[model samples]
Target: MKNLTDMMKQARELQSKLAAAQEELEKLEIEGSSGGGLVRVTLTGKGAMTAVKIDPSLFNPDEAEILEDLITAAHNDAKTKAETVVGEKMKSLTGGLPLPPGLNLG
Candidate 1:
């Protein structure tokens, strides 16, 4: 049927776009900070951590736990941002089409 053919064509185009978007995401970088900017994390759009920074003052051995907590928080922030970026890109590629709940492209 013509409708089926058209749908297939659209799906193919969407797949292509999604592949390109994923590649772009791999190249993109996002930064997240916590602890009043004492700790920072950089992650690729795909949620891979590329780098982490911590203030020298936080290097105290006794305060290692606090540093660890800040790092985790910073990482989580970056990951959330990465997911948001992917979601926005997907929404744009889909032209605001409603996807099923929990239908993650990642």
Candidate 2:
């Protein structure tokens, strides 16, 4: 039927768009910071951490726990940002329709 043929064509186009978006995400970088900007994290759009920055003043042997906590916070921030970016990108590609909850793109 013509309708089935059209549906198949649309599916192929959507698949192409998703593949292109995935490639773009691999090349995109998102940054997030915390601890009054004393810590920063950079991650790829695919949620891989690429770099971490910590304020020199935070380096104290007696207070290493604080530094660890800050690093964790920064990483989480970066991850959340990456998810938001991916979600926005997917939304655009899907004509504003959000993917199902808990759907893992990776």
Candidate 3:
């Protein structure tokens, strides 16, 4: 009974820490760029897009498709970075506890 009680306490503490970690993640921002820095995107650790930047040189109407591709690349880059940040934070929060495969946080 004592061991079970202690386990419950630890579970509650972990839950609290996980919630705090998620809140902290919302405050983090990561930047990613593509097309040799012609395009850039910023994303929060929670995977929300915060901003986008594009070089003025890529504004040609004839290159709309290229611009679109660059934007996609930059957004993907930002998303990947955000995921990595969240993963690292979760790892720290869980004390390296192994999460089941395919169970993404977001």
Model 1 scores a TM of 0.90
* TM-score of model 3 vs. true structure: 0.91
lDDT for each of the candidates?
A: 0.92, 0.90, 0.89
Better of 1 and 2 by TM-score: 2
**lDDT per residue, candidate 2, 1-106, as tens digits?**
9999999999899889999999999999999888999999999999999999889999889999988989899999999999999988888888987678897664
Pitting candidate 1 against candidate 3, the one with the higher TM-score is: 3
Q: List the candidates ranked by lDDT, beginning with the highest.
A: 1, 2, 3
Q: Taking the tens digit of each residue's C-alpha lDDT, what string does model 1 give over 1-106?
A: 9999999999999999989988999899999989999999999988889999999989899999999999999999999998998889989999999888987775
Window of ten residues with lowest summed lDDT in model 3: 97-106
lDDT of 3 by residue, 5-70 (tens): 999999999889888887888888899999999999998888888899999999999999999999
Kindly report which residue stretches of model 2 are placed more than 4 angstroms away from their true locations once superposed. 98-102
Model 2 lDDT, residue 74, Cα: 91
Work out the TM-score per prediction. Answer: 0.90, 0.90, 0.91
